[model samples]
Target: MRPLATRGGSYVFPLILAITAAAAVACALDAGPVNVWIFVVVIGGWLITLSLHEFAHAAVSLAGGDTSVRERGYLTLNLLRYSDPANTFLIPLILLAIGGIPLPGGAVLVEPWRLRHRWWSSLVSAAGPVTNMLCGVVLAWISAGIDNPLGYALAALALLQFVAGILNILPIPGFDGFGILEPYLPRELLERLRPIRPWLPLVVFAILWSVDGASAWLFNLGADLMETFGGNVAQAAVGLARFRFWNV
Candidate 1:
């Protein structure tokens, strides 16, 4: 079997990039349905980031000696390669479109024991969110140079990425943030928490959705990080408004 690292990449990522580029060009031209074009740019870009986020985890795991990630097809960059396609792509996309929430996507499973060290396991967990943060910074840098409406859209997408990075790094159950610390925690505590791991994310999302203060606090932090990265928070908000064009 071909090594996972050598496995061919799926056309989906590049295809989305191409379409998003075209939509961005349309936005540049001040085309009709500008909102729709912005939507395409933001959603398509968001999907690309999601793919990269998971890929970062798999890649780090592979480096840390978890070769099983290869056989599981985690290196493909194909969203379907993940165990749950809906969680990986569909549901998050829906949440983004409807409410502007950038929920973290499906996880790539890693065998912690197979890794070379405890630090490797933690690094593997940290890789995904770090990737999101880096991507957000790069997009923000790109957005900073553009004076067009497309800049707003890109900034909005960058803000989403920043929010994802921040959200994932929180030390909450079922989050990468928690995963980073899992290796250092008492094994007894882990066993106690294991049963509730699956449900915790759902509960967390529910709180964010229903509790105004919680959601505001989260977004406020994201906005602050966006500004720190040189992104225009107000412009990103405008981009988000355009992205949810139906509501505008």
Candidate 2:
């Protein structure tokens, strides 16, 4: 474990460099009026949102008397400390380029049994999505306060983060939301459901692939909420990158 951590630390910088280079090359080769600034903002917002999600998990874990996560240094915004390069960087980019559904990676090295309360564990799990929603709201407010392309881009990024949060929180196996709900579900029920865990990714993928209209409906609903407070700015931001690309 110690060697893995050391190796991971060593490889982190190079991996990020490689991923950035790839993204830049992909963007340059694509034929369109790509808004580089908007892409940057959206990516930045997404990273920030991911950080918050992981930190929330660590925070709740600490509050629940779990020092394991703290020892692992996961209670901060440093994405490298938590992210799995394969899931967070490589796979997502590949899926995005190939027009497939992207899946974000979850946090690193934490033992749930160390927590003080099982309920707090659930709360910690749920915190990621909630934090993303809060970030979206804040970004929407900021976007409404200004009137410029940059503002629009920022708003759009926020909207994407919001959608990501909601999607991640869906109570499916291997998702943080499922972890949150697991504590509350009866142990016997979970045992019965255990057999279905391995097939969850396929099920989730199918849902995303098959339910085109459903995603649109969810986006529309999110847009409506954003518009209620921020008006057109919110709508524009939320819709700007609705189906533009998949960011795993």
Candidate 3:
């Protein structure tokens, strides 16, 4: 990892990255528990990816003529710079730990009105989740060529990337997928959705939580996508099983 000097003076993310990376490496080297390290690696690597996810949005928005994101410090690689810490990190982490479902995380505020064209909004919105998809596909492909513990690690990461990509790409309120469609949404509908937009997450997650077989559907879909992209779902499952420290 390179030196990250940020204007926000935020070092927690780097520290988190260092600790997690060290733990993951140590586990891979047989110096630590495998299950614990899987957890650490997934969570830590996820935080970094969250930063990149937001970066994609900000970067695309800037290129599309929304220069305000840079001024808003959205250009920073710090995870804290992406969105609400509670929403992006804490809540998603808690949910993943307990439910093993990858919830949508992080946000980058881009002024749609400032965009060069309406399509630019779609581009900016699609950029974040697509980045996650690329990471999953690339890493899954890489993991296929390797063996054991290391392959396990990469597979797990790839599975997560698939989960994030699938979840974010759905056209749901308070999700990036829906943001892609927001540009074409009627103003009347936007106004109608205004009050419920905040609660939509709760509603969505609640259904996934309370409904039977919802989590399985998500997991199966994610696994299918990961496999389609050249990832081994079985290995990813082993990695996930090991990482379920609470379950094991």
Q: How many residue pairs clash in each candidate?
A: 0, 0, 0
In model 3, what is the error at residue 115, expressed in angstroms? 0.7
Q: Which ten residues in a row have the lowest lDDT in candidate 3?
A: 1-10
Off by over 4 Å in 3: 1-7
lDDT of each: 0.87, 0.62, 0.81
Best by TM-score: 1
Question: Model 3 over residues 172-238: C-alpha lDDT tens digits?
Answer: 8888999999999999999999988988878888988899987678778889988898889888888
Residue 37, candidate 3: alpha-carbon lDDT: 79
Off by over 4 Å in 2: 1-34, 89-104, 228-248
- Model 2 per-residue lDDT tens digits across residues 177-227: 888888888889889889988688667756765787765655566566566
| Residue-level lDDT for 81 in candidate 1 | 72
Candidate 1 deviation (Cα RMSD): 2.5
lDDT, model 2: 0.62
Question: Sorted on lDDT, highest at the top, how do the candidates line up?
Answer: 1, 3, 2
**Residue range 1-248, candidate 1, lDDT tens digits:** 55434445577788888999999999888797999999999999998888899999999999999998987889867776776778878998999898788988765878889999989988998999999999989988898888777988999999988889888998978789998998899989988988998899889889989987988888888889888888888888889898988887
Residue 226, candidate 3: alpha-carbon lDDT: 89
